[model samples]
Target chain A: MAASGEEVRNMQVILKDYVAGFPKESDMNVKTGSIKLKLAEDESSDSAVLVKNLYLSCDPYMRGRMTNSPVDDPDFSPFTPGSPIVGHGVAENLRNSSKFTLLMCPFPYYTGILGMPGMTAYFGFYQVCSPKKGERVYISAASGAVGQLVGQFAKLMGCYVVGSAGSKEKVELLKSKFGFDDAFNYKEEHDLVAALKRYFPEGIDIYFENVGGKMLDAVLLNMRFHGRIAACGMISQYNLQQPEGIQNITTVVFKRIRLEGFIIFDYFDQYPKFLDFVLPYIREGKIVYVEDITEGLERGPSALIGLFSGRNVGKQVVKVTNE
Target chain B: MAASGEEVRNMQVILKDYVAGFPKESDMNVKTGSIKLKLAEDESSDSAVLVKNLYLSCDPYMRGRMTNSPVDDPDFSPFTPGSPIVGHGVAENLRNSSKFTLLMCPFPYYTGILGMPGMTAYFGFYQVCSPKKGERVYISAASGAVGQLVGQFAKLMGCYVVGSAGSKEKVELLKSKFGFDDAFNYKEEHDLVAALKRYFPEGIDIYFENVGGKMLDAVLLNMRFHGRIAACGMISQYNLQQPEGIQNITTVVFKRIRLEGFIIFDYFDQYPKFLDFVLPYIREGKIVYVEDITEGLERGPSALIGLFSGRNVGKQVVKVTNE
Candidate 1:
């Protein structure tokens, strides 16, 4: 068999080494591997698609999988030594097999907005938070994929939406681009509890928790009686050996607060419902989508690692191939 | 105005100093005090009741109130220096005011059961946990005031009930007296999680979390999908500088668990509803009530401190008067 360029091969970024504290650029390396593009014709195996990876989503959860461990981590599984590092990514059908099939979606910009980042925000806000009209909603890490969508959804529901981001640029995007009721740069704010009180003097009813640790503790103090906290992610404490100490756990009982953590996979069955709700917003320009794309599959390692450092402003995506 | 020879002065315990670490017996002291038996008709307060306490219930939460700077505390208010230690106690109405008229009940024991601990278990289980019939229920610190009642109520609801206690005596009491399906001495069990798994191989549906820290972390691993955890008390962590780190918080999302905390004061309106349910159990002897009474007002401080050390088995009560 002659080795051709188009031959079936598994292209992946392997974990060169385990990470401690902050993961550097050199921790990951892109390497080429091989895989069967075709599947067995046995009736037991269903049709599957061999996808050429397009837009890859860079998220905080990826950092958790970078560590080497003897025991399985409760948060996420440890990354294999010599496998393609997998995160949520948009792809096109390179080859169709018995088990899976794929699609070639709209333009490049539309890919990420319709991809993992968009889906995460769409379902996370509606289903997990269960927002209502005239409710007060707060979003932490507001300019990110899930936060940006959550803020917009809250606004669509006729809610008073306030957001907190790490940088002033992201804060401006939250207000100008996303049309949030109010936005603040958490880095600039001396006290988070005071900041929340300034924006929401009446008290916050629903909180989309994106950054856990001290922020969560402060939010607990500011929550109104019977407040709902949809804990989407904890970017701040994901890579730490020990996450931040929670002092305000008692507030859950006293103020009757409900804090719930969620994953988008649970609500994947409701994808059609999500598309039905969000597609119109995208079409009507009601929902503005933003993407920070780092070009090339070789850059996948850095893009994923950059999530913890607040490098990408909006939805962080690595452009694997221009389908 | 002449004092009777047989009349013993109202001697009560006071917070001698602010607690630093685990509260010591010397942190609180008994002080002899006097009060007027009668008040004038034009008294400033009408709703106040002058009651001679017959029985005082020693509770774990009292330890939390002993500190001076409990401003951040979510549950009960902190105790003031030089003041009589106020807690859940059965008292006789020696003098009546409109505010305290609620204490004038036909059966005083009814108030104790229906007042705080009874209501704690009622709302904590039903409202917080939202327990369904036949769901597997596990209670920690069983044979205590709230735990025993929770186990009994769960059993009545046709749920599989298991409880954990520190002593063999309490374990026997939980199984035979309280009608629990199984009970274990946590002190005797080398592995808490393994012990729980042995009793509940199918996994726990509802865990009434009384003792937090390691116990809570263990139960998190054993919880079934969509499990409910009523965070009633983290008695183990109350006195410590820092509570134990729960490494299994990731299970909260994976298992779709609902962890909620609640106080009894919120369920005060349900007192009548609680009595209607519990009175029959008391009369039919379906519910077993145990009281460990320490005689004399001087011993009250010791009784209160004993709760943290697990020195008292059942509802630890101090007998202040013969009546």
Candidate 2:
């Protein structure tokens, strides 16, 4: 029980209060707490896994957890006033110290292609959209974590994929790195519906909805007959006090479209199947992932808040520890 | 060839102009045109079926056809100015005159339980919803054509069914005639979400969405986890220049709900199977239909317009001819 070089500083990001509108870095605080690295005497529970946090994912869905809204899901909960923010992370199992060396992989890989966003991309595209070969696929927030993977997956399926990103650099990354057939800076496009119509002249067969709000409204107007919308996340609407109205929803009826909302947690049962499907592509270098790593948990607040402002070019990861 | 004494006055309801807001009787004109009962010499094409129109269905979907908005469907077309308004009709085949007697059933039966609305109810409930026994089912516009059948079908499935309608008479019809577990007059209730919560304390498992706008918004807030919303029609929004904004749509994500929009025309191939499934119920008096029939084709304009105002109590039908 004596302090014998086992004590380590665990930096934690805590929520200051329930957020309103866009979240600010001031809404969260980074605190340091000491923890013993060794396993406790009563750590015999097989169900319990002690993990040393390495890489933490900053997802758009995290914004929802920061709000006081009563809408609850098994996948996520609202952030408590003075509690440590919890999300998907890549960690080292401290209980099985010897096994940690065997499980070690690139940290960025765990945060991107081998993580929650990767599973989300796999299920949202294949399971929800059911994209057929030669089908047209459009993805919003295309340079972001899930979006980038979805666009690549669509291309792998022999689909003609187009993506919309916020910045020019992200747009270039979507086209050059992610292998998207076409990419555009949505911020530059004043008329989103017209831009969609331009990209998908025959109309979009599958839409991987990530941005939501105006993008969704525009996409609704441009959807093809029997189109499928995989509503994985609505990043643009997450921080808004009042989500924008989708006026062209009647088009769903006319086109006989299917708009399904899903959480990645529901599809975790297929993680192994997804890994088997995706690992070959990753190993062969057919699928590439981009990561924007912000070192240290002290930068967690700014890194997490940066997602709302499109500051992160790719999968935003906060590196808590090298272990 | 000598002219046979087979000429009859073919009374038709013609669209005067593209309707804007709520349809007025003045938007349509009842016109008389003469037609010969005998098929022309060149009408031997196997694809073409000439029939004598009997009962014309005055459905809420027809309101969409009256608008000039260019949202086109293979099932329906916009009403042209100074042209006969075309829609789903119960008719007797003139080409197969000998088989007419065999097909002759109650006109109201064809308009209600054997026509488009019947198929809509069947597919929207069974296919889209996939209601399990003991599930909670909620139907909006509950005493109308599709709603009544959906309620009865849900009852037959051993599910607890609740319905919402515009008037007390319609609410009574839902409970008494259609055997809904509970019925409410939505017009009387100021807060739809609260009313739905009161009726479905555990939340709705299946929602047969007939009315859109506020009702749908309210239903979104009260849906159970993995709830199915069969978007058959949005009668309330058809006539509005600006449909009401659905603010609680994010609830679809939280609840892991499926909202699918479909046209009955797609399910026409399953008609024989549907007839086999439903005819026995009709014969056993397990299923009943209510029709608000307007006598003569001249009253078609009034009957069609009455749908927008919630004036027609049940399935609005214009009885054009008896034989």
Candidate 3:
């Protein structure tokens, strides 16, 4: 294999078959392959992002993609077996469609906050919740990539924001760096509902639903009339064979809550708008981002597994290459 | 009872006690009650409608009010155990607050199609659903008071509307009188989902939800993307100790269906607009309203109980008095 210039090998991790239950690291195997730097000779389409795949995002929804059932599936096209699973990544554009063979100048995993997690925090909060100033906002998984941005955005919008995280360190990050009005470690809290009541005596007006199941049930009972719930992901229920049953959906009727689920791809038109809003905040240091980068593509499997186990501190990403 | 100028005794059906599970005919006992002709002959601040109860509407929502725990219930306010139960009615203003009570006249049963039920059909459809012309609209309980009005409104909006009722007679009324594009007897149809698919090949754009449970599950399956479901009532599940388990709620995420429950009292400002829109239709012969009037206050228990079993056709109403 030639290491430099036009003739370079592309190594990819391919799924051997469809998954059942939580995916294991052994379910996927890395295969060594070569590309001629052009889709005409190697890949299928010129429109594709030809990247030296770096940090692949491991989200709970990926579990749904691994299943083969046609019934009750999300709108996302199902993942094909024995194919390289594609996801949000920070990567180097190794070759251009314009040239027969293009050389790479890489800052691997350098795509800005406009990536999947960023757009998720942006549109999921603003558009789905339609939050107004001074409205009380509550977020779960507060120190993660999406949660951190959501808290910051809520603060920017002049809202009273509270967050619940997994650890004390994450709780502090939420309160200090993210400027959350209040933060709690959900792990330590004995009664989740009482904790919410203590923080918000008046009640929550908007809930960013990152974790579903019992937390959702508690949130439902506590939600004020006309409250909105942006159901971004249900992390707590993703790995289970049977999702946690919710007993309080009737509250949606009584409270007049608008609970809607959304995918970022459905709102791609807002990407430019999202970039405009978040970029300035990033440059001025008004918005701070934390990424837990695990080096090398071979190590991507463990990093992904870390997401489900809550082992990563911030954004869990893998850096494939550096040039 | 002492009479003034035209003061006739007002007869009412008072709730004997709070109901347990499904209410029977013996649950409520009719009682005679009298209101003073002129506000309290001495005091001055009473300007409410002194209606001569003509046709008292029996609705499924009233069952919610009959429970002692209604205050804790989200859908309705609780009924006083020993007081008169309030509902929609078609009545004459027997004693206008500005005028003295006439000795020959008495206020009628304050329940019928024109009272709360009319407003329920009005705002619940137009405002909550925000229906557009030529859209496909589906309404359940089509021959009932609210359903009848909803079907007519959809027809007026140039929509292709279909309605489902329990009996064949109600189905005919939906087609002939209510002007629905099609009507089906859900009790006779083995496959509701298949029936809906046959009726709406393109899928339903708007669903005015009156009867929930299984029909709601079926509607969810056939709803178009971004479809709107105005959840006015879940009549089918009202009497059950626990609401039926739904298997297809996840469809709300895929189809982007907005299923919202609403109360008419929340949008009271639209009352004048409702009258303005409906009155012309009533006079022009474009609209038709059917009422099932049962005579005597003693029969109120049976009339109200009939609503749960789908025994009454058109609007099930009790005729309390003729002044």
Top lDDT hit: 2
Winner of 2 and 3 under DockQ: 2
Lowest summed lDDT over 10 consecutive residues: which window, candidate 2 chain B? B96-105
Q: Rank the candidates by TM-score, best first.
A: 2, 3, 1
Ranking, lDDT, top scorer first: 2, 1, 3
List of chain B TM-scores, one per candidate = 0.89, 0.93, 0.86
Q: What docking grade applies to model 2?
A: medium
Give the Å shift of residue B295 in candidate 1: 3.2
Range of the 10 consecutive residues with the lowest summed lDDT in candidate 3 chain B: B101-110
Predicted structure with the largest DockQ when compared to the true one = 2
Q: Under the 3 Å rule for N, CA and C atoms, how many clashes does model 3 have?
A: 19
DockQ category of candidate 1: acceptable
Q: List where candidate 1 sits over 4 angstroms from the true fold.
A: A1-10, A15-27, A32-53, A63-80, A93-123, A130-136, A158-160, A187-204, B1-13, B16-18, B24-34, B37-52, B70-75, B92-108, B188-203, B241-250
Fnat per candidate, as a fraction, reads 0.28, 0.56, 0.18
**C-alpha TM-scores of all predictions:** 0.82, 0.95, 0.85
Residue A152 alpha-carbon offset, candidate 3, angstroms: 1.9
Worst 10 residues of 1 chain B by lDDT: B97-106
Compare candidates 1 and 2 on TM-score and give the better one: 2
